[model samples]
Target chain A: MEFNLLAAFFATLTVATYFLTNIVYLRYRKTLLNPVLASTAILAIVLVMANVSYDTYMTGGSWVGTLLGPAVVALAIPLYKQRDLLFTNLIPVISGIVAGVTVGMASGVLFTQLFRFSEQLILTVLPKSLTTPVAMQVASNLGGIPSLAAVFVMVAGFTGYILGPSLLSWLHIDSAIGRGIGLGTSAHGMGTAKAFEYGQQEASMSSVAMTLSAVLGALLGPIAAWLLL
Target chain B: MKYIYTLLHILVIVGFYLMGEQLQDFFNIPLPGSIIGFLLLFTALMLKIYRLEWIESGAHFVLAFLPLYFIPATVGVIEYGKLFSGKGILLIPIVMASTFLAMASAGWVSQYAAKRKERSD
Candidate 1:
């Protein structure tokens, strides 16, 4: 009987928390605070207040997490829709993602050494530019912690999404595809979400960059570890 | 009828994912099953084996809720909360700076390349 009630609470809580986050975002549209950040904060606080264990929360949270695989597969639709534009700008798009991945990993090495961080921390930060799923996989492959990679990826994403526009304008990078690719390569899904706010073209380009960056990051992650570490 | 279509679409997607998993298990591919599934779907679309109408609704439905799927993992951060104290705090500045650099360089490179292409063309 107690288990059933907890199960019900867990099932309902994920949707409710997500809905509440959406409402907050809708009301505070000008703040540029994303639903993911807002909802995670609210949910974390709630769990702490209720004295719930992370394991208990995962019982329900994992259900929500299961959707990520399917959701990522669903991205094929947009990529299909934008196939023509993607082909037309293939060179720029590919190079941009390559540059981003290379620069992201290089900077990570530079900074980790500069700060004298542990090798484990360096491994975790190395894949921060990739999307969460790919980043996590790469981190694990490189002998780093997957969960820490997720946090690093999220931080990189939030930074890119929140500050990306200003940075783009300041750099005078005006091409929609360029801006979208940059944001997506750096921020992954969250950056793509922010790109959607700009226009359809930008959103599509961001998706392309996000997808390519994931593939490239995964392919190069181990190689980078071999070379750099 | 509409709901049936959506369900069928979802089944097709799941089928692709399973097929990709099978291939990966056999061939020892380095990439994930979902990515392989995504590529398979993209291929089918490109080859005209499946029309957009077949999966459009289901795909859009899943995409709409994509952000929610990430929350669980984000919450997983709590598991490692203790690890973030000493050396972890430095991650904030490092991640922020690298992200900025990645975005700026990517945008700059792509834009320059595009403009150069346009001028040459």
Candidate 2:
């Protein structure tokens, strides 16, 4: 059927584009050239050029999206693997993530309000610092558009990846844990990727921070919306 | 044989996700099912209810493609043309400034805590 063929084509296109972009990203190691960002931009342009509707593309794209749930559950593995470090640095880790989550949510709400964005936009921005899947979920839970939230999350990631290192050094935060927490809490996966450049300890710490922030961000998202918006 | 093993591992991970979804619907929990499954799996690992090896390869395989999973959602933004027009440009500065604030606060707090711990030790 035409439907099946179109679905298969779009799906293959998504995967192939991602595959190529990922290779480029790994080779060049530029934050701006992140595979997700590049592939999304590329695919968006291609779809528009082809005059393909979003729904039509999604018939295939949804197959890829379906894996996200299992991927999220798989997150527990890294969290568990890092359990020892997490416990050893429990106080600092917990305090850092809590502060980051609170500040991130509060600042987003404040700025959106200052700009006089709609309630929906405010909710979308509320979970901007969370990892993508979690942010999208939190956004929807707070009555925001999930896809819009995903865009906000990517913006947050890019912002943190670009500015985080300078901000950390300026603050004299030389500790691996500090750098890790800063990047991961503020940027999510992209931040964690940046943390890897710092060293093994920082990378692991960042991953833990990213995971914990996702959990904390989810719990706090609705509360922040209730209080601020 | 290896492929089968990987598929089986994926099935287990998916099973946990389904369980989480079921529990959420039954309890009317506000949390997303994936997160609930995340917590459940973490607890299971901590309690030794599931060995890491059983799920490690599958988890790695899935996580490796994690970024790929969200492309469709991001591409969905093409639908909302108004968001990126005019005043929407202002969102960049807002997001950047807020991200800096978050990075600064989290870094400062953790650095302070870590230094204090070092001194005490």
Candidate 3:
């Protein structure tokens, strides 16, 4: 009975919370204030006070996670529609992903190394640039705790969300392709969402960067682990 | 058209679920099945074997709700409420600080590379 009611509350809350966040974003000219992130902060406080287990949260949370399948499938149309543009500008995007993912990972590894962090912790950091679940999995396979990796994944997304545009502005990096691909590639889907705030091209490029970056991160994650270990 | 796209996605997921592990071992990469299959499908299309018609609709649906994936993530923030109030309060600055640092570093590198590419050309 308790579980059922929790699930019910989660279903209601996730949607309500999501809409609420979107409204907040609208009011702020969609500035760095990501409503979803903000609301999560609020909800985390509420849930902790309620003393709910994570498993209980997942009773409802998984619904959102399950949707990832269909969401990934949806990326196909934009890619197909933009097929010509893809091949035309393939070099820059690929170059961007390679450079972005490599630098991000290498820099992270270098930092952890400087601190003389444990191998497991360093491996966890490897997937910081990808999505949470995927990054978690990469960490596990390479002998790190998934939960620790989750830390960096969130950090990575927030990093991208907060600094992506500001850094772009600071560097005078104004090209749509460059901005979209770089953020998407480095930041994943959340970063892509930020890219969309800029324009459709940036959105699509961000998507492309996201997909390619996931693959590149997966491919490179273990290699980095082996060498670092 | 929409139905076909859904089917393509189903096929991609199933195909990967079955053989993705083997392929990952073969390539010596760390990618899981679903992701590897996604890459394979994209590669096939890029090679022009898998037609766009098969993937277009599903891709549209996926892209439409891409933002929703983060819907659950906000809940993640709530998970740390106790820590947030406790010593975990330290995490606020830690997370915020690192995030900004990581973003700046990534954005800067990308921008620098773009400029370098221009100058070299």
Q: What's the C-alpha lDDT at position A20 in model 3? A: 80
**Residue pairs in collision within model 3:** A44-B78, A71-B62, A73-B58, A73-B59, A74-B59, A74-B62, A74-B63, A76-B59, A159-B99
Worst 10-residue stretch by lDDT in candidate 3 chain A?
Answer: A68-77
**Tens digits of per-residue lDDT for model 1, A58-138:** 777777777766766778888899899899999999999999989998898779879888888899899998877678768
| lDDT digits (tens) for residues A8-114 of candidate 2 | 98899999999999999889988778899999999999988999889999999998888888888999999999999999999999999999999999999999999
lDDT of each residue in B1-121, candidate 2, tens digit only: 8888889989999999999889989998888889999999999999999999899999988998899998989999788777688787787788888888888888889889988998999
- Pairs clashing in candidate 1? none
| lDDT for residue A192 in candidate 1, whole number 0-100 | 91
Residue-level lDDT tens digits of model 1 in B84-121: 77667888899999999999888888888898899999
Candidate 3 lDDT score relative to the true structure = 0.66
Q: Which segments of model 3 are wrong by more than 4 Å?
A: A1-5, A8-12, A23-29, A32-35, A73-76, A116-118, B1-29, B47-50, B71-74, B77-121
* DockQ for candidate 2, C-alpha atoms: 0.84
Model 2 residue A102 CA deviation in Å: 0.3
- Residues A105-204 of candidate 3 have per-residue lDDT tens digits of 7767766666565676667667787766567668878887665566567667767777778777876668887788767866777788789889998888
DockQ of each: 0.73, 0.84, 0.31
Better of 1 and 3 by lDDT: 1
